[model samples]
Target chain A: MSVTAIRETGHLPDLSRVPLVDEVGVEERSARFQTRSIKKESKVEALRMVLSMIDLTTLEGQDTPGKVQQLCQKAIHLHDAMPGLPHVAAVCVYPTMVGVAKKALGKNNIKVASVATAFPSGMAPRQIKLEETRIAVDEGADEIDMVISRGAFLQGDYGFVFDEIAAIREACGDAHLKVILETGELGTLDRVRRASVLAMHAGADFIKTSTGKIQPAATLPVTLVMLQAIRDYFYETGRMVGMKPAGGISSAKLAIHYLVMLRETLGAAWMTPAWYRFGASSLANDVLMQLRKQATGIYQSADYFSKD
Target chain B: MAGSTSRVPVEKTYKIYIDGKFPRTESGRFFPLEDSDGEVIANICRGSRKDFRNSVVAARKAFPGWSSASAYLRGQIIYRIAEMLEGRREQFIAELHLQGLSKRRAKKEVDATIDRLIYYAGWSDKYQQVFSAVNPVSSSHFNFSVMEATGVVSVLAPNESSLLGLVSNIVPAIVGGNTCVVLASEEMPLCAVSFAEVLHAADVPGGVVNILTGYREELTGQFASHMDVNAIIYCDSDTDVAKEIEISAADNIKRVVNRTNTDWAQEKSQNPYLIKETQETKTTWHPIGS
Candidate 1:
C-alpha cells in the first residue's frame, strides 16, 4: 500500500481514550454552586453593587492643574475617611489629569485611566487618533480607553474600524487599549457583538460598551454581548480581553451584578479591575453605602458620606 | 412584557463581507427594511453581484489554509466561540426578544444555540472515522473512499430560527472542511452579522464563511445559479424554492441539500459527517505490486 493510504487508514489516533479531567462532576457542582450565587446576586445585591463603582471624571469642571489636583486630593480624602469605602476601579480623566490622579493615588494602587480617540465623538482621521493615544500613554495613563469611529462602524466600514483600533493599539505600545463600541448607537445587541468582536480581533486589550455621550447607554444586554465577544476572542486567540461597562453604571449593586455575570460566564480569570471596570462619576458613594450596610447591617443615611 | 410590541431597532449600515471582515459593500448600495411592526430599521447595504464575486474570491483564496488546518485547532477555535456565546447570553436574549420571540423562549433558544456550537466543535476531528471507509472490491487493486470538502459551498440559512439555525447549518459545513457563502436570514440578519464577529475572534480564515444579510428571494436565485458555488444548502422549508434550487444545481452538478422542518437539536451525532455527506466522494485505487 502507498504511504498516503497507510497514513489515512492507519488506526486513527484514539482521541476519545485520552484521559479527560472529570469535567462532568466539576461542571455539575460548579453549575449548582453558581446557580445559588446567581440567585443571591440577582436578588440581593445587583443594583447596589452596580451603583458603587464609578469612573469619577470631571468633578465640578476643574480644568486648571491645581483644581484637578484638588479633585484628586478630595477623592483620596474620601477614600481615607470612609474606612468602608467601596473600591472604585479607576479615576478616568483627560491625558493631562492622569498625573494628578497618579499622584493622589500614590501607594493606594487605584488605576489611572485616560480616555483617548477623540473622546465623545470619534470623528478624527486615523493618524490623529494614534497621536492622541500616544500622548495619553506618555502621560502615564495606565489604561487608555479609546472610541471607535461611530461613523466608520455605522457605515459598515469594518476595515476602517479594525484598522483604526489596530493602529491605536500600536500607538499604545505597553499601555492597555480599551476599544469603546458605543453600544447605544450601535442600536442592537447583534451590532454590539459584531463591534465587540471587531475590536477584540484588531488587538483591543479591553472592549468597552460606551463613550457615555449618547442616550440609552450601558444597558446590561449590551455589556453581556461585549463580554461574550471577549470570551470568544479569548477562546480563539488564547488572549483574554477586559470589559468596561461605561456610560450609566452608577450603582454598587449593579456593578457587583456585572461582576457576577463576568465571573459566572467567564469564570474567575476575569474578576479583577484589570478585566472589568465601571465608568461612572457618581457611583462611588452608593457602593460605600451598600458595603457599609452589608458590613454593619445598618442603613446609613446618604448624608454620612456626602459631608466629607 | 407589554413593551414587547415595540419593534427591535435595525442598523442602518452598508458593508462588505471579505476575508471574514464586514467592510463596506464593494458596490455600496443600501435598501431599507421594515421590522414586523413596520418601522424602518437601519438601511442594510444592498449587496451586489460584484460583492458576491469578491466574497467568492476571498473564500477561494482562504480555502487551502482553513481546510488544511488541524482539526484539534479548529475545535479549539469553535469551543472558544461557545464560551463567548455563553458569556453574552443576555445580549442574545435581548436581540431575540427584539426579533419578536417571547423573553423565556428567546433565552432558551439562545442557550440552545450556543450549546449546539459546542456540540459540533467537539466533532471537528472525529467525522472522518465515521464517514470514510475502505472497500475491498474483488480485484488486484485496493479501493478506498474518502470525503474531501467541497471547495466553497453556498448556504441559505432559515429565516425563523435566526441564531440557532444559522449556527446549526454553518458550523457543520465549516467543521467538515467546506468553506461557505451564507445568506443570513433576511428577517433577522443582525445575529448573522454578529456571528461574523465571533468567527473573526476565533481567527477563522477570512472567506471560510462569508455572510450577507438581504432579501433571500431576491438573492437566493442568483446565489443558486452562480457558477462558483460547488454546493448549495437551502435551509428553508419552502418546497417550491427547494425544487427550483435543485434544478439550478443540476447545471453545474452542484450538490443540493434541502433541509426540511427537522429539529437539528435532536440529531444523534453532532459530527461533521452530516456535512461531509453533502460533499463529493473521491475514491482512489492502487495495485499492491509483487
Candidate 2:
C-alpha cells in the first residue's frame, strides 16, 4: 500500500487539518455583503462608525517626528470644521515614533499603535523582535502591530512562528498585540485561516491582514477568511480577537463594506473599534469628505481638506 | 419559410458616455427620447446625482494632464476630434435626422459643427497669444498676465441646436485645457451620443468631454451644487432656472457662466472670448535686472 500521510503525522501542524474554505463561496458571500443598500442616514452613520474604527497609520521609512505629530493632531481633531465628529481610534506609526505620537496625542482618547520587530518583514532574530516589542511598549504604545516570520510560516515551521508570537505577546505587557499575517505573502485563503488560528492561540489580541507594503493586501476574501477564523476561535475560547484589514482599503465605500462584513460575519458586537479596526492612512480624509457631503448635500473637493 | 416568418428588429441602447466607457446610469433610471411626432426613438439613461458625481470625479482626474499638455499638442488633439467628426459626417447627420430634422438642415448642422471644431482647434494654440498681455508696471519688473484652464467645468448644453450648441460649449472649454461634463439636449440627444463616439475615436482622452443625456430639471441642482466642479455653464436656460443655478453655485463660489440664446451658427460664436471665460488669469512678475 502507498504510504499516505507521508510525513508520518508528526509533531508539526499540517495546514490540511484547517477548514478548507470554498473560494467561490467566500467570494460570493463577501460580494453579497458589499451589495447592502447603505444610503443617506445609514450611510452617514456608517461613515461615522468607520471614522471611529480607523487606526490612522503612517509607517513609511521616511516618517519624521513632525509627521507623527501631525498625524496625532489629525486623529484628535478630524475635520474640526464639521463639528461633532468622532476622533479615530488610534494613531499608528513606527516603534521609534511611538513616543513622539503618544506625547503629541496627550490626554486625548485616541490610542497610539506602533509597528515593531523589523516590520513588513519579520526577519530578525526572536530576541531582537522581543526587545523591539519591549521598547515600543515602554515608549507608551497602546497597541503593537508586529509582522510574523513569513519565511517560517511558509516553510511550515508553525512552532517557531507560534513561539515567536507568544514571546512578543509577553513582551507587549499591557499593549494590545496586532499580529500581521501579511496575507498577501501567505499565497492562499486556507493559509490565512491557519495563520489566524496560530496567531490567536499564540496570544494575539488581534489578527491583521497586511503590513501595507505588499500588493494585493487585505482583499475581501482574505479578510473574510481571517474574520471567520476569529469567529471560530471566539466560539472555542469564548474570547474575542479583533480584526484589522490593512492596506488598499482607501475609499469610504470600501470601509463601509468592511463594516458590513464585520456586522454580518461577527455580529454587531464586533462592530466597535474595540473589536474591528481599519489600518489606513488616507481613509480618514475620505470619510470626513463623505460626512461633509452628507451634511451639505454637495460632492466635496480635495482642495478644501487638509492633508497629513 | 421566409414569407411565414417575421424578424425582430434589434434596437440600440443609448447609454451615457462617462470616463471613456458607455455605461448606463448608476441609477438604472432611463427616460424616453421621443421624436417631434411623438414616436419613441430611444430610451436614454436619465443621469442621477451619482452619475454627475462620477463624471465630476473623472473630469477632475483628467484635468491635470489635459490642462498641462502643451498648447500645440492640445491643438492637435482638438483638430483630431474635428478630423474624426468629419469622417463620421454621415453618422451625425443621420442621427440629427432621426431626432426630427430634414437632411438639408442636419447636413448644415453637421458641417457647422465640424467647422466649429476646426475653428476651436485653430484657436487652441493661438488664443493665449491673442488674450495674454505684458503689462507696463511701476516696479522694476517684467509683468505678464496669461490664461490658465480652470479645472473641471459642468456644461448644460443648449436645448435647441443639439449638435452645434453641444460642440460650441465643449470646444472652448477643452481648447483651454479645461475638462467638461456636458449634458446634451433632452429631446435631441442622438447627435450628442454620436459625437461622443467621434471623441472616443479621436483619442481625445477619456474624461475630457463626458456626455450625458438627461433632463436638465433632474440634474441642474446637482450640476450647480457640486463643490468639486470649478464652473457651471448653462446654455439657453431660463432666468428662474439660471437663478437657481447661480444660488446653488454660491455655496462653493462656482463660476456661473450664461450662454443663453446663443446663435451657435454665427461666425461670431467662434471666438477667443468663449475660451477666456473658463480660464483663470495668472499674473507673473520677474525682476528685470535680476
Evaluated with TM-score, which candidate comes out highest? Answer: 2
| Every model's TM-score | 0.46, 0.95
Question: Against the unseen true structure, what C-alpha lDDT does each candidate score?
Answer: 0.71, 0.89
Report how far residue B244 has shifted in candidate 2, in Å. 0.6
Q: Please, what are the lDDT tens digits per residue for candidate 1 over residues A1-308? A: 24222212212122233223333543353344333334433534554334333456652344766766655655565546445444456678887777777887787666678888878788887778788888888878878889988887787777877777777877777777788888888876666777777777677778888888787888766666666667766775687788888877765546665676677678888866667778876666656655564554333334456522
- Interface RMSD of every candidate? 31.8, 0.6
> Is model 2 an incorrect, acceptable, medium or high docking prediction?
high
True contacts kept of each: 0.00, 0.82
Q: Which pairs of residues clash in candidate 2, taking residues 3 or more apart in a chain or in different chains?
A: none
Worst 10 residues of 2 chain B by lDDT: B1-10
Q: Name the TM-score of candidate 2.
A: 0.95
DockQ of 1: 0.01
